[model samples]
Target: MKVGVVLPVFNQEPQYIFECIQSLQNQTFRQFKLAIVIDGANAETVNAVYEASQVLTIPFQIINRTENQGIAYTLNEGFSYLTDCPYLTWVSSDNRHYPEFLQALVKTMDSTPKEIVLVYSLYHRINEEGINVSNSEEMHQFMTSLMRRPKEQIYSVCFLGASFLFRRQAFEKAGGYRNKFPIAQDHDFWMRILQHGDIYFLEKYLMEYRVNGKYSLTTLTPSEDLILESMRSSIDNRKTIQDIPKVSVLLTSYNQCKYIDHAIESVLNQTFTNFHLIAVDDGSTDGTQEIIYQKKDSRLIGLFLNHRGKAHALNAGLEFCLGEYVLELDGDDWLDPQTLDIMVREMDKQPPNVGLTYANRKLWNQVGEKLIEGPIIPGLNYGDKYDVLSNLQTHCPRLYRKSALKSIGGWKRFIDGQPAILDDFLMFLDLAEKYDFHWINGALYHQRRHEKNITLIQQEEISSEIQKIVHAKIKEWGNEYIPEFIFNEGSLVKVDLRPRGLS
Candidate 1:
């Protein structure tokens, strides 16, 4: 079966385009059809592709689009156009393949089972000066960690350079490409198609990825910065975290532009590095999103939305989470360096019945710039679900087990602008109903109280709803678990929210 190669061409230098076509012609395996699709580039760029197709001895076609569609659409169009070919793949005009590239890939696809949807190989990059750089740490490190991990785990950012053969069946089943991701269109395809079947990895280097092009990932424009950030955010949030992160920290913010940088830095400073920070912006008007973008940490996934309520943003962030345990933090709050390791250790010690765990927090005021107090604990004990629900915990500092959180269906908000207050309280109550909780002994987070704090204003507005939810849940449970009943009897909550000496 002849392999169909789709080459998406844009405004690249003519010499570079010719080199891409020349490499394919020199391939050890000759049974391939080369189709070049030109997407509304300049006259010179268009002529380069046309000229390359003329020089080729192999069967080829040139598709010229009058208007610029994009890399994703050009790819999908090429895939659909090549109906007779069973194996499909694409290469950027800026990339060139080794003579043995097609041969190795075809041989592997021939011997492997049909279930193998993709065949990718290691690739080296060529710097602008025509020097061959060694394999990137990203690809090597990625493959090394990937082989040892369980298949159930998911990952993103797996590229075998610019050319990898894909079975038309698998590509078709994955719905081809959505064309939504712009620069990251290929990444989107990789993520979706992975859901269908396994991908085979080859150790041999197959393609040379040229890095000097203006539109290459190496060269980023200011707006493409956001696109690249979103791509990284998407990849980092994918199920397979580096070294299998045990905890996911959901750090949410609205417009704390000044404080968010520190908040992110504190998480990065944590002693426990095996965690992913899913940072969500609740449509910040200021530079809150921009500040988040300033961070270069791979662990931080920055997502931007348009003025969704905090509850909606929180729930939205949960969609990208892939952690076993989840920690909730605010944009104004910062965590102590040892908080993660400590909480993880505490949770590790607890039985599966324990759904949540929290530690004491140091209270600080943004205006005053002074420590308000140290070791402030919730005035609740969590020996049982009843007591924990009765004293609904706020966002002082807590980590939750994902499975138990999943069972309760995550955070709920009044989507139709009912102004869903007390979401954290409801989340606390929901988890408390099914599993117990425990408190660690030290202060690991700093909760900065500010005048614009959402929690401060939401308390009075949501008090009735909090009571109503607690009352309804207790009623639906139809058992001895009663908040009023426990309060009337005056039993201390198993979770002590008092300050250290006070407790």
Candidate 2:
């Protein structure tokens, strides 16, 4: 089982290039070849590649070009040269592969079905000197379980940056990478090949992805909107509903005229375009109804109601849903752009027992300008029945299975004198008996905190509602509920209400 590895370097340091070559040379599985392509690298890098090829014992193929054609063209040249190898993958110049990287990928591909085009393993991000700079250690178990189901739709970049061994046939079938996506060429290629065949995730650490600390901690394409639009085009032209929507996004607003536009735009610009959006105006006297009618998008289903409370408005939106999953967003708050897509994909990978998955979120100051703090679930595993009963965790930004939600009788109708948004908590309590919940690590929602917010009621009233809800659920579900934060604890939770910060 021989494989081809393409190393595309551009303006990278010679030492980093050597580190890459040495890492490949040290692989446990030896049946592989390195196709080194230098795209506008400095003199030192070109010299180093040439020098390393002479000393390396593995099969070496170097394509050093004189002019600086972008990474897309350089990678294509390397891909064209790999016609002799059956398996394919590429790595950045600054990253290094583990000894078992090739072995793990080959071993998995050999055991799996032939239709699996690529098998990408978990990778860590390292800085210039190759020091680990992230919490990748914690995600090992969490992500391993998440990737078992391969039918999910991907919104943003989730695969190992450049750490997969792909089938050569699939590459040709997908027409290779597109040059128009300067930085997102690989992601574009991934999207294309995913349509051709399934992708397998190997749960081993295969490589280290280098990050440009000078620019950003991550390597997402700067032109993400362009990539999203290109992906949308592919969906738009699909012959069948296989790639069509399986999720519905609901945003209910009463008088959020000032903030409603941004909320609507966020949903409209999602990378995963399959889901339908229903924005209910809840009979706002303000210009919120006008704003809802302004979008004129086919995916958007705007409905106007007569000053109904949030519970009534949300149920109205749910009535028109055609998708299997539902994403709940607030009228005053906006999503992280990728929230709907990522959550829907994550939910797709879940088992029958797992009915919902929520992600971490960012809390913003009044007017939603400054990012005051970033918040994550207390732990990755805090979604069980007992965990939910505990007053420690608050759940929001939830993506739910439409069937499960409907089976549970949809949103709990809010009665007067109830804590604001307590209906959501009641809905979750009932769902907890029959379904499971999972948490994703990334913070993708922006929660606005201000005087006019719905959940900003008095602390004593909130505490009373939460205490009543938790104890009632405990009795109903036969689970012990004990909270960590006791009397005099700060950071604002319901005095009696069951709510989390910024949810």
Candidate 3:
């Protein structure tokens, strides 16, 4: 298939523009054309692209608009010149594609049915310091869900501008770009096309999205609230929920009926909506099952089984999870109304290597009074496996990547040649080695402490469970794992209980 790769450029660093073009030219698939739209970019950026194209011996066309038009106009202009090509793809002038980027996307689209109008793969990030990082699973999960959805709602979430490939026919039917919104023009175009057809996702890393560039959204749009408001508007205008991100909330509970409603309420109250509530009552003799059944929401998937353990309960819930992503919520804990929406947004922005985006959690008292006012840990960042291992000793509400969990065989059913518990820790450890972790640094999840909760107690057996999981993780990561870290004394730092509202 013939491919037309269009790049819309504003002013970009000379070196980055050159590197991006070089990466594209070296792509494994050679039957492609590069359409460079110098959308009023500086002479340095245009010259860089030309120099790289010549050195690589890759033929390219430079479409220079006399005036500085926005990316939307540039994209439309570029597509106008590419009417002859069968397949169309685009990337930001600052972004780089992997060698197999086009090959994987083309192969997936070609093999899939004709109904699929768009094909998008995963992507990573490179910081301004040139350090490479992976996007979170939260992003992958959202894209995966969009791929499965009916056309309408899919576009609202997965319309990432540069990292997508589409057929020329579908592109035209979608009516090209909306030049109105300078920032989210891609979002507008994707929404319009969802009226026409379906989308497909390939679970592969195909590109590197530069997050730390001076011209990136982080700089252009500095207000966090404004970014969120834009997201809210996008969700509000979506017409249907056919392909909404399916969430399987794996609630592992022993017997906390008093707090179950709070957790369930938090989920049911999410403005983003559309999810399955899988509350695995871990052999709860309390009225927890009754409370769940009384909810009467069709989305609630209630499973009642004998008391095996938390690990067993989670695994059972996993078996029942039809959603693209799973969040393990303890029966006594809860989340904010925008928890899923915010977390999913970050996930959509992350690359494939990031298996999860977990924010900090808050501690609440029995009466639902706020206690600790901050995250369990402060200032956590994504993309380091080592940090994940150290923090797994104490963390909560980490939304795990469904595929990564499956690849690790769904939480080790056993440990140390014996039946094991704390399977969640084991699962996190396994994933930490292969995939990176993104920490949101907010208290979206609310953890409660009371007499009925197992987490409230300090047991020797619990420590043993943690140690067993740590050793198992060591076996997997080998030298890559940290040495000389133990749970007992100074090996790990312990948190001191303090008055409410104080850190």
Candidate 4:
């Protein structure tokens, strides 16, 4: 069977296009054709791809469109030229694949059933300097966590895109990508295909996704209104799923009298209905307790106890949690209306091994002057402990399996030093070792960066002490049980993580 690699390019940097083509040229599995579609691309990018393909002696075809149609349109047009290929695989022009990518994917496809319409392998993101900047362990944990659900249940988990190899028929059935979603078009396509059949994940790194450079297509032109509307519409669509996995919303708060009402309102306003809100008061000295008491929603349950730190507070909240899935929301931070609904739906479609799911979170700074968008590292697969340890810059609100959290013994309390500093970080490390995880591409949570928060109060000293503890534990527990933790000059450490089931 033949494999056709479809790369859609438009207004990309020349250097990125060249590097992307070069990776394909060096592929160890050589029997494939490269279809390069330049969507309203400039002369420089079109010429660069053409030159690289010629120099590498690889069979390639280029399709240049007269109008600057978007990526979705360009890719649909690229598929029009496929010449009797048995399979169709897509790679972004700004991304590069490993030499053995095709060989591995073909092997997995041959072993799996034909009805499994989509196949995706693990992938990493590289900085402009070609340095690796993704967390494979976290990605593995995230993906496996989602995968653990049921073979057919993954439709509720996530929509696999880009680094995926798909049957041409499945691609066509999914309607060849919708034009309505200029920003989240890939997500829309995956959701459509998942409704038909199952998706498979090959637990191996197959591609190098370039990030952090000025020349990347990942950067979009500044259109504030469009961006917001796109985000809103995406959430709306994600919430319209039936038979979604049950979710438990975990809220941790202490003395948030002023903002407690707003936080509660956020949870109550969620569009996804099959969820319970578990709030731990954590010994609030302020009137936060009264506000929670006054509220009367069956889904909202409050645990009012003396100060036991954030870790214990979460553990307390978990006791009251009855949902099959769990989401930890800081009392000070609120989620968009469809956050739980969308994420839970994504988690439901994953296989039984995928234990946790997370999504990018938008930032609402306390100043309220400007809203900041988080980095896009969702759907990034981190399958190793060392890689997870190194990619510390990317983090956001996440969801977890209730059983998976319990399997890790809830959150760990520092036996020796400051408990507040690296507690959440430490908890994530332990939970990651036992369960698989993945990140939803959408921003579901709205994080508020307030000066008075516990994270800011004890982050430096506490994180410093926790790093020493977690690093030492990794050595003590063996690499598999302890995800890799690397320390920098700052107390913050990068975690390298892998799927727990891997050897």
Candidate 5:
């Protein structure tokens, strides 16, 4: 039941060292052991550590090494001696834990289901002078946002902050800290260990992470190459496939050569591999078809058709879909690796009548050559026929039952004889009429907005088309389908509707 803590020290300031050790000494829960690993310390640092170790009343050990190995090596060396402790965690020299840090983490780990092998808590970001830099409320909101992501996404997002505890078994299974990604060792380790078991997030702030500019490893930025290599390795290692796909993704594009490859790769690299990608190119004269043919994944099926609009291209892709659920992805957009896994799992939990499930989306503006992140468009929890018709951009990463989609005659050119610019919206309206819609909370879809985007190029035309469709649908469904408007003063404020006849 004892917790093992490793404090890895390089050339940190003596005052910080004393304060860190004092934090441990004053812990509310005392059934813990500390290992102070001094990695090639200078004479002053070694003496300072010796002086700081005097105040510790608990059982502790100091491991001194002559060579200046990095954090990963030092961590491995320190944990090697704490084999008797069931729970293990490591702390940085510049950080200080709250008195209840060890107590709360141990309690949570003890109470958590056996499937969860690790637990992490929120932490306060402090300046060099120990002044809190981040607002408490803001930090809580930020951490809560990260907590919404499923563990399947750990490879892409690292929500495990400074304060964390893991079972020794998980540590052993992960093979300890890796030396490969020296700067991103913790993130790499988290990705590897997550494969073995789930991680629990404790919402309390339990530690003060000191941002001591040059003295802290947190300030060091890992090279983008290193990050990409680490992510690629982690993703490749975690790839799992099912013999039968549960979902089929239809990625349709037209002259999107610049972004098509990334979109295809995003679908192929998804953590949930039980889906096939049907990438349809609608006569791209800009080499988009060439990139689609170049990809060699067995799960990918490439189709090059004559110049047709998106609706036609989607219907073409639909002809090859072999999954129970279908998702349509724009070629200029990509997805989070965990999108399929999370959406499929969520959809499976709903009733058969819930034919559609979608998640939030991240907006990106692709100017000339740069891509800039915009605000996240949160998905509506429940969308009725009214919401679908009113909101132009409803939800994304929309995973729908293939049977339901087929029953409604798939995608259609709802506008003139030509393809409809609001094809997705039209599809949504058709699906909304026959089935219910559910929403998941994470920003799983990456929507890129550029000059070449259809929605942007034909905004006025799309608006006019949407209005015509809405009026026609309202007329067809009669008074029950027409929305009742609530007016404030002289302006209209809200529209209320009770749609209850389709079931």
Candidate 6:
């Protein structure tokens, strides 16, 4: 029933050491033992730590090593001496805890269900002079936000802070801290330990975390490469266990870093939560892949590939989808909060022959810093093969049956050695041929028309490609006559699909 505390000391200041040990001596919970592992500190510092430990009335041990091992090794060495205790925790030499820290953490641990193996609390940030660096209310709010994250997202951020207590059983099961991530050892440990059992967060400031200290790890800047590698390891170690979701949103991005986050957040915050978001980055040089990898949602699966066209990227994402329905979303555009909820409900009411559902879109013309609202482009509630072939506007936010998409082989990669300029339109044509289409009436999609928009930049090429695709599909449908367009001031006013001789 006792808590085993491990204090690993290395080149710490005498004053901080005294304060750290004093805090332990003043703890309200008395059934705890301390193990101080001095890792190759100079004689002066070692003597200071030993002298400071004299105030402890509880059982204590000081294990001094001649050679300096890393924190991970030193911590493991300290814990090896506390095998008799049931609960385990570790502390730094510079941090001081409140008198109620041990009592509150132990009480929570004792009352938690058997599955909860760890409990961590929020802490206040202090300067080198032991003064609060941030407003207490603001700091509490910030730390609480981090601790409120989903358990599956623990790998993304180390919200455990400086105050934590864990069962020795869980610590042993996690195999102790790792030396691979010397700089991010704590984060790596949290990620591994999560696999054993759930963790509880106590919403109290139980300790003072010293920031900007001379010898603090917070002052040491870990390389971006190291941080990214650590994140990759965390993601690889995550075990996803869930039943198949109702919808799979395939989001493809290429050099769209500025708008990718908005697109992703839109999907993640949807009213409908029964969907997995598969984000595919097509070798973007603008750090788009990094943004995707940093997302902390368990429902998000990020894929990074070599530079590929949109068609290829969509096909790549389709390979991993495990949903009954699939929605192909553009990385630059975003859907309304109720987009999935409304679409899923509508699709559920449809018959088996209906393979696709689309909603209206609101256009935002981005000129400089302004986003000029344009007209609402309505969607055809029901479209046949002829309606899809003649309409110039590509429908927005299209949801398709996964089986139907798989039946037509995801997306068409190349047509006449050219990547499909209108990938969505081409796919719509393919779907229109076999399955019926349903459309929702609301403008649930936001389409941003910027200077870099693919449709605007390659207008002529897209038009030409569309003409060729339409011609081939018509011929394949055994039609002898090709459709002609009647234009008014360069805009298509009507489509003449009658025979050429009759026209």
- Give the best candidate by lDDT: 6
Between prediction 4 and prediction 5, the one with superior TM-score is: 5
Whole-model lDDT per candidate: 0.74, 0.71, 0.69, 0.69, 0.80, 0.83
TM-score (C-alpha) between model 2 and the true structure: 0.51
User: Model 6 over residues 385-449: C-alpha lDDT tens digits?
Assistant: 87778775568888999999988887998888877777887888888889999989999999988
Ten residues in sequence with the least summed lDDT for candidate 4:
150-159
Per-prediction backbone clash count = 10, 16, 7, 49, 0, 0
Candidate achieving the largest TM-score: 6
lDDT of 1 at 284: 91
Model 6 has an lDDT value of: 0.83
Misplaced by over 4 Å in model 5 are 222-226, 229-233, 239-503
* Backbone clashes in model 3: 7
Q: How accurate is candidate 4 locally (lDDT)?
A: 0.69
lDDT of 4 by residue, 188-266 (tens): 6666676667777777778887875665545553433233333333333444544323787888888888777888889
After superposition, candidate 2 runs with Cα above 4 Å error: 135-137, 141-151, 155-157, 213-274, 277-450, 453-503
Per-residue lDDT tens digits for candidate 5, residues 1-503, read: 39889999888788888888999999999998989999997877788889998999999999988789988999999998899999999998778899999999999999999899999988888898889898677666856776655676664445577889999998898899877777778878887788789988888889999985467765565433344444444434445323346888989999998999899999999999988787878878999987876565556666677776788888877866778899889999999999999999999998988888999999999988999999998987545676766554557988989988888999877565655777777888888888998889899999999887766676557556665676677776674665554544544334455564754
Model 1 TM? 0.57
Model 1, residue pairs in steric clash:
154-240, 377-497, 378-497, 379-497, 380-495, 381-493, 381-494, 381-495, 382-494, 382-495
For candidate 1, lDDT tens digit of each residue in 268-321? 899999898888888898889878864656566677776767887787777667
In model 6, state the lDDT of residue 331. Answer: 86
- Estimate TM-scores for all models: 0.57, 0.51, 0.48, 0.49, 0.52, 0.58
